[model samples]
Target: CSTFLHKLQRKSNRKRSVVSSGELHRNRRYAINPLGHKWDHHNLTYRIVAFPNTLNRDDTRKALSIAFTKWSDVSPLTFTEVTANATADITIGFYTFNHTDCWWSPLHPCFDGLNGELAHAFLPPRGEIHFDNHEFWILGKSRFSWAQGVWLNDLVQVAAHEIGHALGLWHSRDPQSLMHPNATYTGQRNVGQDDVWGIRRLYAADKKRVCDPWASTSASANDEILHEKNCPLRCDLPLESELPPRHVPRWLKWSLRCGHKNLRTTQNRYKTSPRASRAEGL
Candidate 1:
């Protein structure tokens, strides 16, 4: 079985080529490395520092909270948003100016020197998520909802994907998985089964490795361990609580109730730039 690192090494040695539509096609069909293993439990708690621009702060926090809650449901993992001074394992921030945006790096880098992955996250000891700020950043409750226009990937959706990496999930071949490189808004509340399984596997594999300071194992060993502790041996419980429907803001509900024709005709006066996608090549 080839590990993620093994694949990376092989890719690096190969000639760098333009990521033609052909490359994207190959990537879509690319299988999950038979080598990547489940996560071993480390410290189950993580801290995130979300730096949203003042204009978008409220929406950013709301979206980020929803993203965090998605993972908490799958495992014993808990998350907290902290101030800059707080001791945290993970720090998340957004870019306001497009001058230094790195979001597109996963897709295309400046020079010929390119890394062929979408997002890359460090294991436990290294915790940070840097998103490219080059793209527009939009938030919820608008005309056409998530159904209209150019459908550049959704801000909240991208955050949710990167957050999966922050928690130790590898990219999944399952297009439905949140871990997939490119994703659009699906209006789902949680990670898909494939994403959950991948993260759960990480928890089990990483737990022991993180605790055993004396053990020196490679990615191959971790992969082997995960294959042995596969999904059939696991059990999952549904934890999503039903939220009581409260009267939402009148205008917001009215917008949804408005006929599709009206929605298409009305330009969104509330239209704002969307947040850039998080593209750290896996």
Candidate 2:
């Protein structure tokens, strides 16, 4: 769940989007979509509907595989790639600015080339993830060369962040959690305690309740989520909680435009503080 404001500054006007990537806070817990979106089953399948030219297929698969494991390691959720004729539960692709029709359902914002709005993904059931093809995606923890003009964005890190969205996780208030929206493009990240709490709670609640996925969506307080009041009934309920969080207001996008700076020395690169932009869709 990172945002164009992630430059994800989430790039969408739809209410279902959860564009991410900004902000940090003390050790806190994670958050779920207020509307309540999540998989009912622990075993899940995903497929690469599209792959980026910037990365080799083998490397891309390798990276994404590791990223999915980050979640499975902390929860009962298991992810398997579906390459055969069968349709997968989740799909991933990369697109540039205005590649998809904005008027259509599940709408999202156009990519802005380099900085803001890095990537966005849909919450559960829709299972779609999109990335900006324009960025310089790379493998490894985090390293960039001013001379080579390569401001490498880590595929593993960003994919992991977006995967959280597909899993129905919103941005975590915890700065170190992999679900944190800000400072994503800068380096490698792992699942933190806050994230574990979120994922576990989501599925745990899922098993204990009865939901009606087709129930017409309605509105109430944010606390209504995860309370097991209705076990998040209504296939598409009143809330379609999200992450990667496209589908936010346009004005918020401007505020989400944050960047890093002044890494003048390679030795001190790790010490560079990322811009503290507001975490979108939090």
Candidate 3:
């Protein structure tokens, strides 16, 4: 992952372009590359050298394909998945502890095992995404027990965040964005306006195509697609235990006591609430 301080210098020298007010607002909500490092070409290829046992091989492939499509749909970039033998711009895999040049290695930052730090990726040109195999990874929707240190980290969500790093995006302050440092279990399968603007800022959208930066795609549609592909496990529903104690509002505490039958049901209600969707940061 790109270091926060090293790449955050303000880009005051580059000429600014006029964008839609909405897009402009979204762009301003996040951090961008100071040096503006980005892929020189539009077509990029990626190869999956390894797969996690958390999801079946086909599910893993489908999850990554959708993650790539999220970015490709709104940007000029196009991603082609190639075999391991073929040369590719990006390489992805799962690892634990000191796997090669990952965080624990002497060359890179140290990775905290299991729950603390989930994954990291290099910036553009490097194009390497590594997931911590120590953590439990989940595909779509499935029952998970957080108390057992078995909380399922959404693979597609993490893939999307790591891909942002690969595509030259730093972590965004906007928590709703796919580029946020932490993952949310709200079943956000589509890119947010903040992510769209950030990627577009790095590489302008293709001239032949027009994209809406703020359009919301149906998460249910994506879930249906995954189910149709035979990847039945869906973990999109919110887990009450997953919500940090700091985030639980006093009003929500009262609601939890009176409005809902159980913690799971309360969380499901909270997940759909507009306030929860807008809650910022990790």
Candidate 4:
């Protein structure tokens, strides 16, 4: 493991780097890291600049390999490891404090020793995934260690989430999606449909669909939505009920919940001048 001084030195060399320091986007569904900072190509390369001391190189690589696979299974993108990070598009590391920074640094001032701010990543074209060395990372079935009184962060799940940011994704509000900002260590690790659309919206070639996010919802579905919820005109639900649907696009649900005015506001934000991606902390 080495200082990310290597990453800082090469700042001038990246194609279209992202800073992740702009205004907040909508708090629901999936977001492209603001300013639409995505990898322009599907085939990308990554490098692991550091690792946890508890694990060996081979095991750590395998964990990260599975994390990248979660994205490749649903998108046209691909990731290859390069021993030389200087040529790699994305770089991974584990750092404790000011030597490295992320979207989360402002709140806790880099890694908050122990359970807070487990990790954060930069958006695409500046793919830097940094993990917290303070937390005990594991590739196990459970997330917390009651015996040890600490959170046992799953390396694979957290890597997948950071990889989402590296591929130009923002934190999603859909609780079931892997991109959700809050559920990273609570065992919601699967890539949901929101996660799939978030990636495809960034890299897909087909541009036929209209930009209206709510246009696809018919009057019938809208009626069903309104009738199903007691709160007419508001899509509010208890946290326990925000499960992602099997075949529905997340926008439809967002539209139904937010109503026309808020939906228009959200659409306007995208239409306005682009800002950098927001810091998505865990």
TM-score leader: 3
lDDT for model 4: 0.59
**In model 2, how large is the Cα lDDT of residue 159?**
87
Give the least accurate 10-residue stretch of model 1, judged by summed lDDT: 273-282
Q: Could you give candidate 1's per-residue lDDT for residues 6-94 as a string of tens digits? A: 34534433442322221222222222333343234444444545444322776766777777778765554667776667787776664
Candidate 2 or 1, higher lDDT: 2
Clashing residue pairs in candidate 3 (N, C-alpha, C atoms within 3 angstroms): 103-109, 140-234, 140-235, 141-233, 141-234, 141-235, 142-234, 142-235
Report the CA-based lDDT of candidate 3 relative to the real structure.
0.61
Instruction: For candidate 2, write residues 1-282 as lDDT tens digits.
Output: 333223332333133433222232233356777668899887899998778878888888898898898887666578999894669988888777776553353435667777666678888888888888887777777567698686678888888888988898877656777887673843438887667767766776323222323211232233233222223211111212222324444232222111222223434122111111223221
lDDT of model 1 at position 68: 78
lDDT of 2: 0.61
TM-score of 4: 0.60
lDDT to native, each model? 0.42, 0.61, 0.61, 0.59
RMSD to the hidden true structure, all candidates: 20.5, 19.6, 16.9, 14.8
Angstrom error at residue 201, model 1:
1.2
Q: Write the per-residue lDDT of candidate 4 for residues 107-217, one digit (tens) a residue.
A: 224666787677777766778888888778887544667999987778888888878877877666578888777656557777886677567667642122221222224
TM-score of 1: 0.48
